[model samples]
Target: GLSLEPILLALCEWGQHHADELNEMDRLADCIIRPRQARQPAIA
Candidate 1:
């Protein structure tokens, strides 16, 4: 498997340099993981 420590470290550095972009990326990831309709109960 590939080592992620270096990649994560780089991401942290980048995030520090570009906080706003990182925040936007986090928001986009949240949207992707939890769409609006996901909050509703499924109708069986």
Candidate 2:
């Protein structure tokens, strides 16, 4: 059987390199959406 270790390792490396940028974008999205969401009424 072929091993997936190499594929996973490459993905991990890619994520590590972009982690900061990814986190920053997530933070920005939360900041932007949360406040706006708070002002809106939720539909049940």
Q: In the order shown, what is each candidate's alpha-carbon RMSD?
A: 10.5, 14.1
- Backbone clashes, each candidate: 0, 0
Winner by lDDT: 1
Per residue, candidate 2 scores C-alpha lDDT tens digits across 1-44 of 13555675676666555766667534332211111223567799
Quote each prediction's TM-score: 0.38, 0.39
Q: What would the per-residue lDDT of candidate 1 be over residues 1-44, giving only the tens digit for each residue?
A: 13555676677666655756556655332211222333668799
RMSD of 2: 14.1
lDDT of all predictions, in order shown?
A: 0.51, 0.49
TM-score of 2: 0.39
